[model samples]
Target: MKLSALVPLVGVALLTVVLVGGCAATEPTPAAPGGTGDGHGHIEGATEMPEPQLRLVTLDSAGSLTAFDPATEASVSLTDVAGAELLTSDGRYAFAAADARLTIVDTGTWTVPHGDHSHYYLAEPRVVGMIDGGAGAGLGRAASNAALTAVFFPGSGETVVLDGEALGEGEIEELARIEGEPHEGAAVPLGEQVLVSSPDAVQVYSAAGDALGDEQRCEDMRGSGITSVGVVFGCADGALLTVEGEDGVEFERIPYPAGATPAESFANRPGRPDLAAPAGRSGAWLLDTREREWTLIRTEQPLLRAVAVGDSDGRVVAIDALGRIVVLTHEGVQATSEPLLAADLVGAELPAGVVLEVDASRAYVNSPSAGLVHEIDYVDNARLARSLDVEGDASALVEVAR
Candidate 1:
C-alpha cells in the first residue's frame, strides 16, 4: 500500500517501491559472481553490483536487524542483536551494541570509489560476529576506513580495532585492543595505527598495541570521521584534523570562533572532507576539512538533527524542532518541508532513534511513530521523495552501499 504522505499545502508526487511482502524478511538472493568485476579491481568474496544502490539497515526496539533496498524495495533479514541499543555503520559494515557486547554485521552491499568513478558490490548479508568485552564494548560511536574498523567503549576505556578485510570474510578478528582510563572518547582506524582519543588527548597506537609519538591535546574530544584527506575529531573548543601523508601524521586544530558552542558530534557522507552537526537548537555547524575552516549555518527554528550533504550547492539538510525537514545553503534557509513529525517531536523529550541520514542525492529520516523511513530530496525543495517500510520498526537506522 502506497500511503499518502502527510504533507500539508505541498503536493508531493509519491512513488511506492514494490515490496516482496509487507514485513517478514527471511533470505536474500544467494551470492553469485556478479559481472561488476569487469573493469574495476576485484573484491574476493563480493560480487560487484551494477551500480550504487542505497540500502537502509535498521535495528528495531526488539533487536531485529534488517536491510531494506530502496531500488528493489526488498527487505532482507541479516540477524538479530540481543539487547541492541545502538547502531553505527561505515558504509559496508554496521556495528551494533548492547551494554557489554559489540556486534558487527555485513550488509553484503558496498561501494568503492575509483578515481572519479566508483564500483558497487552485493553479497548475501549476514552477521559477522560479536566483540565481547568490558561493561559497554561499543557504547561510543564506531569509525572505519578502507582497512580497519575501530570500536570504542567509553565506559570501559577500551578501543578494539578489527581488520576490514577480515570482516569481509565474516570474521571477528581483533587487530588490537588499546586500554585507557575510562572517559568519553573516540577511536579512529587510520592507516596502520588506531587513533585513540582520551578525555583531552588523541594518541596513536599500532596493531601490536604499542603507543606511538605525537599525542594531540583536544579538550572533551568525542566524535571522529575518516575522510579522503584525513581523520576529523570533534573537540570542546573546535575540531581537530589529522592527516597521515608521505611525511607523517600531522594535526591541525580548527578552533571555533569566540563564544561559539562547539558541536557535540559530527556526521556527513562518508569519505567526504566536509562534515555537519547540530549546534544548539537553532544553528548547524559545517566544518570544511579541506580548507580547515568552520562555518555555522543558522536557522530560525530549533533543529534536532543536521547532516552536511557536501554537494556542489553546499546543501545542508536538517530537521527542525517542529518536525519539518529544512534545507539550508550558504545564503541560509533555502526551503522547508511540511511538519512531518510534529506529533513525534511535540513531547518534552525527543524519542531515542530518529535521525537524519544523507547520501549523494537524498536524505532519509526514520519515524518510529510511523514505522516508515521518509526520503527527502533536499535539492528539490525538501520534497518527500518517498516513504519506505522495512521489516522492523526502524528505531535505529543507517544507510550503506554508498
Candidate 2:
C-alpha cells in the first residue's frame, strides 16, 4: 500500500487505541498545592486565612469562655472554667478567678505602638495555665511593664504576686505571698518589691519574701491604682504614692486638701498617670499621679461606675444611675450616650457593669438582662458603634492583645 493509505490506517489505529485505553484505565486526579478537591471539582482549604484583629473575652453565666472578634463579627466558644470572675487583662493575658484557682488565658493578639501608629499581630488564643489563688480572690491586677501580677484573696488576707511572663508560659511561680488580716488587705507588685496592705500601713516585701523597708503609713488603705509614675493607695487622710528613685524606691504621702472629703478609693487604667473615683454623692475625684495633684469634678448625677481613660486632656468616663454613659473632660461633659441598659437595673445585683479597658480605643459595657455588649468609641464623642448579643449572661468582659 502507498504511504498515504498507510497514514489513514495509522490514524485509525491511534484513535482506536486511545478509546480502548480510556475505558480500561482509571486513575485518581491529583489535588492542588495545599488543597484536596472533591469529585465535583470543589477544592477545600484553598481560601485565605482570617486576619488578626482585636478580640473581646467574655465570661458567661454558664462558666464558659467566649472570644469575639469585632472586626469579623465572629465568636468561638472556649473551654469552661467554673466560678470564674474578677476578669482582668494586661493587654496580652487575661487572669480570671476560678474558685481558689487563677485561670490565665492567652488573648492571642497584641498591638505595639510606634510613635503615632502601631503594629498588630496574632497568636494562638488558649488557656495557658492556672494558679492556686486560695479562697475569695477579689482583685486580679497585672503590671505589664514590670511583668508581674497580683491577686488578692480577701478570705485568706493573702496577696499573691506572680511572674507575669512565667504565668503566661504555663509556669506558676509566686514572687511573694504575704499574709495579713483576712478580708481587709490588698497588694501591688512593683518590680522586685511587692506592696501589701497591713493593719495600719502599706508594707513592702522583696520578691524573695524579705521585708524591704519600714512600712509606709497608710491607715485604712482600701483602693489602689497603678500609673506610669507609680502605684497609689488611697488612705483615710491622703494617698500613698510609690515611685522608683535613683537610690531606691521612694514613697510619698500626698494628703488631700485639709477640709476636702477623703477619697477612700480610686480606679485608673494600668500604667496611666491619672486616677478617678467618686468623691461623694455628686462629685468625682481626679488624681494626677505624675504631679501629685487632686482635682474634684462635680457631676449632676451620682455615678455607679467611673474609670479614668488616661487621655492627654484628663478625660474620665462614668456610668450614671440611669445607665447613661457619660464622657467628661476638663471642660466637662463632652458626650453622653443614651441609656443602653435598663434604668431599673442600675443598683440591682445583676452582673452588669462598664469596663474601660486599658489603652483600648473602645469601651465595652455589658447588659446582663439583655445579653448584649455595647461597644462605645471613646475617642469619638462616645459614639455607640454596635452591640453584640452574646451567649449566656455576659457578666464580665475583657479586651486583650495577643
Candidate 3:
C-alpha cells in the first residue's frame, strides 16, 4: 500500500478500540434476506416511509455536501456545503457545522421508494436552518432533537443553541454559548444531555446547558501521553464515542507507577493485537457505567482526523485519514470500496486520495482532488455507488432521513 498517504489515516486508531462490544441488549433481529428489496414486496407500513434508512453525506473539498445512498448505491442529492466541519444525525434532519448550512433531503427517494410520498418529500426538500457556530468560529460538532439543535465549536470552546426551525437559509444568529474547550474529544448525545470525552475526563451536559456533576477523570492528566483521541467508542443508551490514544498507556493515577503516562499504563501484554504497522496514533475505546468497566478496542493504524462508525450487514464501516474506506468487523478489516480519483472530491485539486463516513450500512468516501464521492455498501462489501465532480474537501459526514 502507499505509505505516505496512509500514515495520517491510521493516526486515529488510538482509543477507538474501546467501543466495539458494549452495546445494550436488544435481541438481534433476524438478518433481512439478501438483495436490495426489503423482501416484504412492499415493506410493512409502506405508506409511512420505512424507518428512515441511513444515507451517508460527505463534503467534497470544493465545499459541497454530496449525499450518498447506501441501499441502491448511488448519489441521491447534491447540496452546496461551505464551511462545514461536522455532521450528525437523529434519523430526522442532517445537521452540518458552523456555516449553519443544514441540508435536509428525504431519505426515502435515495433508495427503493414505496409510494408517491417519496417523490413529494424530495421535490421540496427543506432548508431547515442556517445558524452560526457562535462568534463566527467554525462548528466542530452538532446534536439535535425534535425541539432544538445544539452546535458545538471546539475551536471557540463554545456551544451554540438554536430553535431548530427558527433559522433557515439566509438567516443567522448567535444562540446561547457554553464554556470550555472540548479537549481533543468525541461527543455523544443522550436525549437531553451530551457526553464528551477528553484526555483527563469525561463530562456530561444537559440540553439546557448544565454540567451533570459526574466527572470520570482518567489516570493520566498530561496531554502528551495521549497520542490521538476520539477514534471510535461504545456507550450506553445506544451511544458510542471513539477517539485516539497511545500504546502502553500508563497513567500515574492508575497505580502503574509514579510519572507513568497514559500510554505507559499498558504493559507487555498486548491488548489489541490486530493493529497494523501505522496503528497507535489513534484507536477506539468502550465505556459503560453500568458495567463499571472500560475496554480498549484495537483498529487499523493512522486513522482519519475524525471518523463516524456505523453497523450494517453485521459489519462496521470506517473512513480513514487519507479518505481510504474499509469494512471491518470482529473478523478483520477488508478494503472493499473502489478508490476515488482525488481530483474529483477536492476542489483545490490535490493528489487523488480517499476518506469516508459510515452510517447504518453505507460508507461514503470522498477524494477531494478528484472531486468525487463514492458510496459503498458494506452489506456485501460492494461498490454500489458513485458520484462525480464534487467540490470542496469534505470535512465531515452523517446519515440522515432526507
Candidate 4:
C-alpha cells in the first residue's frame, strides 16, 4: 500500500517517498485533482469505480520520441517522429509516418529519415509493419520481420494488409483489405487472427485478409473521444480495459485511490505530449491491454509519451516532463534511480559526461547546456551510473546502429 511495500514487486529497493497522506488533506484543485488526462471528462460515480489500465506514452519536450527494445535493454532510440503529435508503438519498433510513406525506424538501428525523399534506408523492420490513415485518424502497428503490413487508411475506410517489404521498390500490392475506419488499429498475434478496433467496433481477421466474422460493436461509445484504433491492450476511460467480447465491447474499469481537488485547482504542466498525460495536464494512467482485465497503473511523473518494446516481454518505458525515465515491468513501476555502471550507481556525485538524454535511459544522459553525454549506471538510488561525453548540442540522441 506504500512505496516501501512496492519495492519487491518492482525489482528495486529503497525508494524514499517523502509524502504519504500527511499533507493538507484538502481536495486537489480540479486543476490539481489526481486523475489521468485521458479527456474522458469527470465521471459522477467514478469515485467508487475500480482502477482501470495504466499505459504511459511519453515524449520529450526537446522534439523527440522515446523508443526502446523492451526485450534487451541493449537498444533504445530517441527519434523525431516527423513532428508527430503523438507516438505509439506495437511493442517492437517505433512508427512515424508522413504523407503516404510510413517510416519505420528500428530501435536497434536508430536510423534517421534521410533527405526527406529516400525510401529504403539501411534500416529494416523485423516483422510486419505498416502506416495506415493520415494524421488525426490513427496509425496501425507494423511487425518488423513479417512481410505484411496491417494498415487502416481513413480514405478507404478499411484495414488493409499490404506487402511491407514490397512497398518501397515499386512493387506495391494489397494482400487483404477489410472494411473498417482508420481509427486506431494495432496488431496482436492471436493465434491465426488479427483483432482490429475502431471507435465503434472490433473486427477479427485472418492473417491473409479473411474476415473471421467476429465483430463487437458498441453503440454507446459514439464520441468517447477515443479516435485511435485499439491495440491489443490500448487505453480506455479511467484505468479500465477496453475489451471485445462475444456480446460486445466491454469497459472493465478498475478502482484505485482517487484524490479530489478543491475549486481552486493546480496543474502539473499543460500541453505535455504524453498519451497517459495528454496535452492539458500532468500525471498519467497506464492500462495493460496485454492482460485480459486491464490493470490500472498510476504514477506521479508527468509522462510525455511512450513506446512499448516487445523485445522486452512487452516492456514499456516512459519519459517525464523533467526528462526522468520510468520503466514498466510485470509487477509495477521501477524508476532508474542511478546511472548505468556499478561505480556510478548511486550516492556518488554526478560526474562529467553523464547527461540524461531527454527521456531514453539514465545509462545515457545528455546535458545540452554542458554539451556532454554522461554514461549512467543506476544502482541503489542514484541516477547516474557513469557519465560519458558525446557530440552534438546534446540537442537529441538517436540510436545509430550498424
Which pairs of residues clash in candidate 2, taking residues 3 or more apart in a chain or in different chains?
A: 108-402, 109-401, 109-402, 110-402
Q: Write the per-residue lDDT of candidate 4 for residues 184-293, one digit (tens) a residue.
A: 34443232345555655556666687767646553212111111222223322232234445654444543323441101100111111122322113333333333432
Report lDDT (Cα) of residue 88, candidate 4.
31
Deviation of model 4 at 380, angstroms: 4.9
**Stretches of model 1 off by over 4 angstroms after superposition:** 1-45, 136-140, 346-349
* Candidate that beats the other on TM-score, 1 or 4, i.e. the better one: 1
Model 4 residue runs over 4 Å out of place are 1-96, 104-147, 154-158, 163-173, 182-191, 218-231, 235-302, 306-317, 326-382, 385-402
- Model 2, stretches more than 4 Å misplaced? 1-53, 111-121, 135-145, 343-354, 358-360
TM per candidate: 0.87, 0.78, 0.52, 0.42
Rank by TM-score (best first): 1, 2, 3, 4
Q: lDDT (0-100) at residue 24 of candidate 1?
A: 37
Q: Model 2 lDDT vs. the true structure? A: 0.67
Those runs of model 3 whose alpha carbons end farther than 4 Å from true positions after fitting are 1-47, 50-91, 98-123, 134-136, 145-148, 162-176, 186-188, 196-199, 218-314, 319-324, 334-355, 359-361, 381-397
- Candidate 3 C-alpha lDDT tens digits along 30-126: 4433332221122111232334544556655455666655555566555665655556544445655535334433233222233443311122234
RMSD of 2: 16.2
Between the candidate structures 1 and 3, which one is better when assessed by TM-score?
1
Deviation of model 1 at 135, angstroms: 2.8
